[model samples]
Target: MTTSNRCVCPDCDWVVDVPVTTTEVFKCPRCGHRLGGGAPVSERHTLALALAALILALVSLWLPFVGYSASGVSQTMSLLDTSAELLHFHERLLAILVLFTVWVVPVLYLLAICWIFTRLLGSGPVGPVTLYFIRTVVQLRVWMMADVFLLGALVSLIKISGLAAVELASGFYTFIAFVVLQLWVANNVSRYQLWHRLPHQQAPQSEAGRAAHNQGLSGCVCCQAPNSPQHKKCWRCGETLSLTRWRGWRLTLALLIAAALLLVPAHVLPVMETTSFGRTQPNTIIGGVLELWQGGDAPIAIIVFVASLVIPVAKILTLLVLLYVAERGNDSTVKNRVVLYKVTDWIGRWSMIDIFVVAVLVALVRSGQLMSVYPGNAALAFALTVILTMLAAMTFDTRRFFMPTTK
Candidate 1:
């Protein structure tokens, strides 16, 4: 192997020897996680995109998102108004969650990116503040859900179109532009380049010590940088480190059990109850999918059924099996299992689409008796299920599966 650098795998803690002359991107030998890619992003371009994203976000939030009209009455919806409307209906928790994920988190994340880029691209010395900004940006990334909110709006538009006339507003188009810029910045931002540019500090562990530490090094879950085992937080991103390697089975197991329990009511109970022209009807997750299917929205129904129903139950089962396997000392197939873990982790976020739909419908359709929507108990239950499954995935330790069989 032609080699120039070596690093511990973030997922499995395998000591990987990277090839210097190879033309391909490096992936972890054990978990198949992408270690690094070709050519670092230029400081100038990354900074430009970050600044542009912030500007677009400001523009998007201020413009009216959409308009609804029926029975000689009309109303407008703005990006921030969704949370306000949700709050009016006494859905305090959903209101706060929407306010954070759709509005506050995205703005804070963009600001953090701009702050980091300003310092890293400037001639000024990057001290501990760089680490602070890096960590803040990482945490904010998970909470930012502007693009996801856009998808929810699309679903709501389709759902409400049959009952009322709908029109896209300036904010709707502006929000799409904001989402595009967000994606651009994410693709161009390079942690590898930024880490290299930060002021050099001595690794607490000597070269021999790092070698001896081997699989013991703590990897920053956010930036995936390997840090000394002695540190309480990541050196690169400052993310809190998980010190123990006992697999977090207790926490993970508890979350999975909670998620499984919630999943039952989530499917059985009504997710949305709508009243139109003095007639009331309730729709559960499966019932809504079938309703959509009967109404010639086979594609959309399939999407909702898979995202809200199939994915959650599948995630629960997959996590449970993996937990049992880990306890059984099956270290083989770590790579495939890690891949499964990634799928479960990423797909959990999309399950929020239904929750978003409920919020939108309740907000958009609330016009005294002629047409109105009230979220059923199942919406909260389903949302909680999504949250629990995501936590379970986060708490699970993939490294333990690859560790040598314990005596």
Candidate 2:
């Protein structure tokens, strides 16, 4: 029912008048979901920040990240050390995930955004290549975790400071700067403006037009290009289009259940084992937090407690509630449910802090009984739980919540 100046709220389906001014930010009145926001950063500034980020990324990878010295032994690790150490220990899946998050995805994210920005700043109208790359950047940005990796590194440093002389190596500070600049770029650069400037050459029909044209249109999952019910492929991006948004509900449920089951051993079993002078102690997630609390690192303890314990539980419970509500066809709370889903999806990856901490410890603390740390069974289980929950969030189609309820 809405026209060019109005859009159906992604959260609630309420028609919203698009804000006019560069300073005017709009939030969905019913759900408080941000409908739109402020102006785009200047192209020159965004491009400069992006290039600086590239430099910092290289320094982060090339230099020694941090070092530990104790009992006449000293060891240092670089950014790649985490994945290399995991692979050396035959944890192939973890190594791949870490490598992807820390290296591959972040690089791809930076490059893809740079490419899109270049196109936006150029003389010619934006093409399919630019649109596809922009969409790709959106997907890759969520999985990039250099910032989380740094947090995990700091927590790991605090945990081992008592047992070893821990030094923040050059790469560590470089990584800190890199993370800050990266976030600045993300915040200052507006994707909305970029999308606006693009020619919309092959974009699917407007939401209002599609609905009025035929109620049977399917939205492309990739570029959101609307296609007729008889069409198998999206007209704009060529992605497959399907009418059944609920097609994979069962798979989402199954993954959620598996993640919940793993959350048990993830908390119950030891995540890391430490052996010092022939005295070995295994610490589960709760035990580790308590240890930090008893050791006077209250802040770090609280952080660990929230990241390792609270986040996983909250993510699982929240997703479960959302799935149930979404499947139930509740009309009134639809917008609230979308807000909840977004929050749950965003925070699920941070639960990997425990796993990252274990990786750094396993790699850098290999002193022979002076202090040696090894990955425990719970590390694998916990990592799997995080991965499963992420998958579950992705499998859930948020558009389903926006559908009209069938009474």
Candidate 3:
């Protein structure tokens, strides 16, 4: 294998040859991470989908997203209201988070895609600005949560359906379209193809079919380009490369510790308070799940339980285990450990579903005495816990799975 076809697996540190002309899906034999050998979607198609999604997003903003009527009182909520109402209650941080994840990030991602592909279509070279936009696109993909927010919105509606008249509006349908188109664009957009189109400086000569780390090389987290450990930045995308294999796990451990501490209050305190006919009841995370279960919405209850309780606890514990495995240099099950890290990283974001539900309910349910919902202290704590766990997983260097013993 030569420099042109050699690629390093980001998850397992395995070096493999990837042919440019192959159309079948490529997977790392060591850890099963997708290496992107499928037929690439055309830049024109991706650009068009992105533009369409942007239009739907803009339209969804001004239109009413959900409408609720109770005791002759009706309330209508637009998509932006979910975050705006949080601000009204002085949850500035939560409001900003919800706004960014649901609206701001997706819009920015779509705009970045449109800009990058437009430049590509013009046959222009990938300059610094285009490279910056490309990096932004990749980073913003995980934060785009319109689809998750949609599920939370539906759950919010279900929680109040028996008490009032609930109706989905034009904005809801438009957002559904936006989420679908956005996912289509995300799934088909190929980072491998994007970087291949750009120019890359020659890498130092290294043997093929061996771990890049063994040859003093590190894979760029941003562009997947192999870089010499001595180089501060990647030759392809200019992303900063990690110089040492043993770095980051200490920080990951610290974050996991903090998240574990916060998990206590996140479960013990109420996530939201409900008021009905001058009566107020505060519901903790598990309390809310139990309410849903006893109300005959067992499926939604199960969904909430897993997403809120099971996933977070499991993710924290799993990351701790991975850190221990990495430190112990247990290469016997490195492959399985890599897969576990990927699963935890992917599922960690879904834990925010409960947060989104709180935001939606706080914004959508408002009626004097008849019924109303207010966010609780646990809302922010739980949000922080989820975010910390996500950062912990990100800070964990997967390459350590293939590392020898660390002193």
User: Each candidate: what lDDT?
Assistant: 0.74, 0.74, 0.85
Candidate 3 lDDT trough over 10 residues, lowest sum = 1-10
Off by over 4 Å in 3: 1-4, 242-247, 327-332, 367-369, 405-407
Q: How many residue pairs clash in each candidate at the backbone level? A: 0, 0, 0
Please give the RMSD to the true structure for each candidate, in Å. Answer: 3.4, 3.4, 2.3
Q: Which one wins on lDDT?
A: 3
Clashing pairs in 2: none
> On a 0 to 100 scale, what is the lDDT of residue 213 in model 3?
73
Candidate 1 lDDT at 273 equals 87
| Per-residue C-alpha lDDT of model 2 across residues 1-407, encoded as one tens digit per residue | 21223344433334445553445666766556665667757777787788888888988887999998888888999988888888887788888888788767877777777887787678897777887787787567778887888888889999999888999899988888888888887777655455445333454345442231234445455433345666777665554555335436788889999999999998999998888889999989899999999999999999989988798889888877777777566667776687788889888888888888988888788545587887788988999999898988888766567555521
- Give me the displacement of residue 132 in model 3, in angstroms: 0.8
